[model samples]
Target: MFREANSTLVDREWRIAEVCQRLEHDLEVLGVTAIEDRLQDGVPETIYTLRKAGINFWMLTGDKQNTAIQIALSCNFISPEPKGQLLLIDGKTEEEVGRSLERVLLTMRTTASEPKDVAFVIDGWALEIALKHYWKAFTELAILSRTAICCRVTPSQKAQLVQILKSCDYRTLAIGDGGNDVRMIQQADIGVGISGREGLQAARAADYSIGRFRFLRRLILVHGRYSYNRTAFLSQYSFYKSLLICFIQIFFSFISGVSGTSLFNSVSLMAYNVFYTSIPVLVSVLDKDLSEETVMQHPQILFYCQAGRLLNPSTFAGWFGRSLFHAVVVFVISIHAYAFEKSEMEEVGMVALSGCIWLQAFVVTLETNSFTILQHLAIWGNLIAFYVINWIVCAIPSSGMYTIMFRLCGQPSYWLTILLMVAAGMGPILAIKYFRYTYRPSKINTLQQAERLGGPISVSREYRATTTTDRERSCSIINHSTEEQKPSLRTSSFRFS
Candidate 1:
């Protein structure tokens, strides 16, 4: 057979090599050979922990189906026969592939009520056919399955799978250690490359490159959670502070007969975001809602990030309502305190602005989970700077705010108005926060309480997710802050080629 095939491929060297390789594969083995390769330490535990943290993993490889299944079983990626069912999808013709896919889908539905695990195994040929003609059905199958293994696939096929997941609105993370995985890594929402024996091609092309695959656990559970938390607070607080000032301006417009009249001068508007409110939120980037140890222990806390509990429409609405409420308090209190007396618009503006500054100071203090000396300085020093800058600006004879701060400083009424605004603006919010922290605390709140009291967090079993399905379902909605989901983290050392 080899001689005949070689004879037919006389001038085509590539075709001759392909024909010879196919002919040689069916021959009986003269001897058995095995290579001893071991996984890195702590890999299985890391995967288990991350699975509990709500990340679903799919194995895509160039190895044969049996080899991939063996590796998956050894690594605890899927359970064996009794506990888990591996549905195979394959065929040469389009019709055969469709029939196989439908059968698997039917089996999945049949076992939908069972506690047994389900995973679908597909080879390159069937995947190609399914993706071309039955992508929607394939997508549903992938989503329903606890895990999936795509074996005997090409580099492009891996990327195509990633694209399909993304098209279904699921965020994907592709991690690879070699050149063949470069396309897949780049195609994912986030690309993580493992710098190992395979090569540097994937690492160089990836968004982040890590030295070891096991470090992925920390990358996701600890650092990934922190990044999400910090980014959510920073982005939302930015909008909150800006909206606070804007809402005040909109209220001022009503009293000014809808005419365009600036409440605070141009300088104050410019300085509010840059100097006054910027530091605390910037410092908040270093804030941790829970300790690293606690986060690692309670990986289920990641559900908040995946579900966007921190910065979703609900949280945004809360911030929006707070800004509007504070704006109203500032405007009404300032206007009423100076109603009968002869007061300049500049003085009223100063009164409202001072209230804003003080209220912001306390808001940051209230929301802070862990406070360091730096945070104290950023919050308090910023308040001091506001006063000092205003005092200096009022001293200048030509400035619009001239004598405004000085007059307000001398009056007990100015101080009273500010006190009144702060109380009215933040009193309800602080009360609600206290009530929730004391009575209706979440797991995060409990963890935060433990951190504050410097005690060990004793998480209840109920706090931990019971099933893998529940955990993955919580990870369905990527946080809504960015147009794209926050970049996920994954790491792989498999040589796809």
Candidate 2:
């Protein structure tokens, strides 16, 4: 009875102290409960894949520092090999925290030249101090470390860390499976939520939700990269195709003394987007340019996401130049085939229309590698539809809209001229394609070389070097072309860390 009374008095004193100090709770002796939390399968392999992709992995957990470290080891985030180095920072005072950060910075600077195999484990207090006072130093330390763990961190701290990284120009990706992670998920550039035993609050808040963590490997490396590449290609192709058609019409206007007349009739214009040109791009969207094995073999492709590597100013200019060239070829061929004075205006218009349609078809066909039966049908269907529409419009009485149609669909020479013009216009484009194929450097060869060297870092260096060299070449070309005025192009290199 006396012991119980003493314990009550002590608890009362603790509660009063907590109220006065604004502490979390009073420390009292309580019964311990042991609960087992098993990790999901394939987590280690997933972490390994991310590491190979040059992604920095961090764990912000409410668990104790030791528990977090043990889980990190089991997940292969903390390597078991002797080559790994663990840097611990758990200081209670500002001076202690400063000293710990200084030590980490010193170690990082000393080993900056080598491939680092370091992990950092810091408690909440130390993290707060480092972030508040020595943020730049902390950022450098985190960038150098292979993995980082912040135990006893609140959800707010996780979000703050993500924001800090984003401010530093890092494309942060936050993945979590608990309600406590919702803020972090929202804070990051890409939020991936794991639908695990914790709950679905994080999943609801995330941009993408996955059943297992291992799936993130495929999600980011395969699907993400594919989406970016495919979108870039499609966007460039769409602009090029449209610009080519527009330039052709502009050329026709010049020949016609700036008449500003429409080249194709309403029906053909409608069919171009809805039927003739949509299938190849749709198919290309689903097309996998590189196989899974290729991606896994050369993880450097993942780095392309950092900048506009796939689609940039140089590529856009190339597409524009090609579009202009192709437009001129088509126009010159059609005009030469049917002389401006010899042929009627309607005849010239029909030839121009047919050439434009066929050019679009050729462009679509060239964009794809292999054609499926459905794509083949779409292409043929567009041609058949155009001819059938022309026949119907011709069969109708010569009216307000059918006057041009009546003139164009008259003789077999009209059809023959179109076919000849299409064949003629394809020559330069085909030659250019062959030239590109013959001289273009093979990416597969570079990947094979990197594999033979047995170092992914070498591949990364080679890619950066190639990018730098290309930028220098482009700058030199600009300088030579415009000697009087100099153009400044920003050449910022990507940092994987």
Candidate 3:
């Protein structure tokens, strides 16, 4: 009865946090209960795969240091082997924490020249001191360590850590499943929440919510990668098709005495962009460079996505160059095909437009990796619609395009000119693609080939063997790129699964 009364008094004093906290600790332990929350299925394998994909992980928890370390090991966040050393940074005061941080930094530097499997473990008390007094040194240490565990940390500290990583220009993904995690979830670039025993607060606050943690593997490697690839292709191709027409116009201006006479009728230009070219590229959103099973098995391919290999300056330049070349081919071929004949300017415009449509179609065909039935219908149906629409428009005797399609379709040279444009535009692209696939095949390229042949992709083991190297190289690239910025050193971006 006396103990119950004391507990009630303590609860009532909760408004005074310091007094309430002191009373909470002073209470006697009448009994102890233990509950085991085992790791979910596939958690370890998923973590392993993500790590191989060049992602760093940091575990922030309110659990005791020993308990957190145990959980980290059980979940494969850190290795069990001797080589995977655990460095601890803990102290009660500012001076002690600073000295410990310097010592850890020294050790990290000594091993920086070689590959080492090391993870740092820090408790909340020392973390608070280190972050407040030695933020730069602590940030450097965090950058060097691939995995870290911060135990006994409060919700505010979790958010602060996320902010620190972001301030360094690193992308952060925070995952949590409790009310205490709300701040951290809201603070990150990408927040994922698990809908489980911890309740719905985190899920409500996060950008994405999942039933289990293991689903993260698919979320990032499969959907995330597909989204990036499709966006890049869509954006770049939009530019390519637009530029293809504009380049032809610029070249035509030089020959047309620079009087700004439009090569294509305004209606034709509108239809080309809105109806003729839009659907095919839109369908490209469904494209995949490799199969889901293949990507899941060989996560090392994620290096390409992490390193910005697909959507970089070099790729944009290639697309720009391709567009310029195709425009030149279409314009030069159409003009030369009717050089001797007394063709109408509208006829020349129709011929050139035809070549652009066909060339763009084949260009999309060349880029598509996985084509669905819907994609098939969109591409071919759009092509057919181009002619049927033009034919209908040309039927209107009052329209500028009157008899244009009919006049061009009757001539065999018109068809030959289109064929030449397609052949010339596609020829170089195909050759370069073939050479790259045959001689310098990337992991994704190899998977694409195997998928095409309906053969077994047994390269998982081979890829696993090189995952360490790929991860190191990815980190090296990020670190080297950010080496110059000291006060606000941009660090490697991290994605948490």
Q: Candidate 2 — which pairs collide? A: none
TM-scores of the candidates in the order shown: 0.88, 0.77, 0.87
Better of 2 and 3 by lDDT: 3
**Candidate 3 regions with alpha-carbon error over 4 angstroms:** 1-32, 460-497
Candidate 2 lDDT over 289-406, as tens digits, reads: 5566667656656756545567888889978987887777667876876765586655565677677677667766766544678776666666676667666765666522355555
Clashes of each: 0, 0, 0
**Alpha-carbon lDDT of model 2:** 0.66
Please give, for residues 1-497, the per-residue lDDT of candidate 1 as tens digits: 55665567366676677877877886988899766445556657776787777677788877778877877776667776687788899999999999999999999988876877787889998899999999889988866665788887788888888777777666677777877788988888778777765568888998888876667779878988899888888888788889988998998899889999988888788888889899888998778778888888888788877766787778988888888888888888877887446788887788888888999998888888888999999999999999999999889999888888887889888888888888887889989999998999998888888888888887674344455433334211110000111113233434211
For model 3, residues 1-497, the per-residue Cα lDDT tens digits are 33454557545444355555656886788999766545656768888888887777888777778877877787788899988878889899999999888988998888865667788888999999999899999888867777788888888988888887776655677877777778888888888876655568878998998876678889988998899899999999999999999999999999989999988888789899999999999999999998899889888777777666778889999899999999999999988887448788888888889899998899898899988999999898998999999999999989988888998889888887888888898999899999998999887887888888899886643343344333322221000000111223211111242
Considering only N, C-alpha and C atoms within 3 Å, which residue pairs clash in candidate 1? none
Show where candidate 2 strays beyond 4 Å.
Answer: 1-35, 142-146, 256-259, 266-271, 293-300, 305-307, 339-341, 393-395, 398-440, 444-497
Pairwise TM-score winner, candidates 2 and 3? 3
